[model samples]
Target: MVVTRSETQTGAQTGAVQNSSEGWKQQPPYRTTEGDEGFEKKWTAHCHCGRVRYWLSRDGPLASKFCHCVDCQALHGAPFQWAAIFHKEDLRFESGAEGLAFYHAPDKSTTHRLPCKVSCAYCHAPIMDEGRNMVLMFPGIIKFSDAEHKKLFDPQCHIFYSQRVVDIHDGKPKWSKLDGKSELMKEVEREGSNTILGEPKNENMQD
Candidate 1:
C-alpha cells in the first residue's frame, strides 16, 4: 500500500513517473546499505536541484508497473503512475540525507503508520516509496536517453485500473487491484463503457 514520494507529490499518476537521513556519500556515485558492497556498477538517483544523490546497485527494477488508483492520482498530478520496485537495501543517498522530509500515513486497510512519502527538503522531489520489503522507485528520475528510457522503463501491467483517471492502450494487462498472486495480466483491460480502442481515456492532469 506504499507509494513513492514523487508519485504522491505529483498526484499518483501511475502512468508516468523519498527520504532523508544520513551517512550518504558526497560523491557522484552514492553507495547504499549493505547487500553487496561487494558489487560495483550502480544507478544513481537525485533530486531536481541536484542537491541529493542516491544509487542502486541493481541494474534495473525488480518489478515495474503503471498504477491507476485514486491515491496515485491524488499524488503525481498525472493520469497514471509509472513505477519501478527495488529492495530498500538497494537504494542509497550520497548526500542531502539530513535534508530529507517524510509524510507518514496509514496504508490502505491498515492501521500502522508508515513513511510512504519521502522528499528532499530543498527541491522536494520524490525519492522512493518504502514498502515492508522493497521500495517503489520512479523511472522518471533517471537521466536516461530516449533509447534507454524506452528500453529500461517498460511497465509489466496496470494496477487499480478501475480507478483510472484515464485509459492507456498499450496492450499490457490491467487488474482491478493487487493481483500479484492471482495472475499477471497478459492483455489490456477494455471494460469501460466510455472507452475507445487505441486511444487514451481522457487523461486527467489536475490533482
Candidate 2:
C-alpha cells in the first residue's frame, strides 16, 4: 500500500467524467470501479481535511489487516497501516474529483510501482492502494455513526509484523508476511522488536 502526499482530488463507475480524459492525469499513471449484489452503502471514508471522499459499498471486505511493512512504516508514518481490501468495483470516489493524484510507492527492493499510490492531490489523503486486482482503503478513515459500522472496519490480523516498530497487544494474529504466504505469529510474539523509526515522522503527513 502507498502512504500519502499534499497535492489533493474523484470519479464514477468508470468511463469518463466531465471534460476530463480517460485517466485523471492528462498523460498516464492515472486510472479509475462496481456492483450491487450483496452491496449496501457500507462505509464512507474521507481525507484528513475532508477534500477527498470514498464511498464503499460491499457486504464485507476481502480482508482487513494491520500492515507492519517497512514501506508502510515510512510511507504512512504510522506504527502500522490499517488497510481493508475490497473489490475495485465495490469502491467509488465521492469528492475532490478534480484534484486526484498519484505517487510511486516505495519498494526499495524492487522500486517498481505502477500507479502504486492514489490520494487526494489537495490534502494528500491516501484514497486507495490500486495494486493487484482490488483496492486498499484505510479502515481508520471510515466514518461510522454506529458501533456496528465501526466493527466492520476492525482488522483481523497484522501483516509483516516482524518489521513492526511498536507492539500491538490486541491479541490479533500477526504474520511475518502475507497470510498463508508466510508464517504466523501472535501479536505478543516477536524475536527482537524494533523501536519506532524516528520522531515527527508525520510531518506534513495526511490521515
TM-score of each prediction: 0.66, 0.68
Model 1 CA deviation exceeding 4 Å by range: 1-39, 107-115, 181-207
Which one wins on lDDT? 2
Q: What lDDT would candidate 1 get against the real structure?
A: 0.58
Q: Model 2, range 48-98, lDDT digits (tens) per residue?
A: 887776677785688888887776777777778888887776766653245
Q: What TM-score should be assigned to candidate 2?
A: 0.68
> Taking the tens digit of each residue's C-alpha lDDT, what string does model 1 give over 1-207?
432233334333332211233322332123434454665545666789887767776777877988876666666677777888876666676543456665544433211123356667788887766554566788888766567745666898887665565656787767655535323433434774465422323222221
User: What C-alpha lDDT values do all the predictions have?
Assistant: 0.58, 0.59
The alpha-carbon root-mean-square deviation between model 2 and the true structure, to one decimal in Å, is 9.9
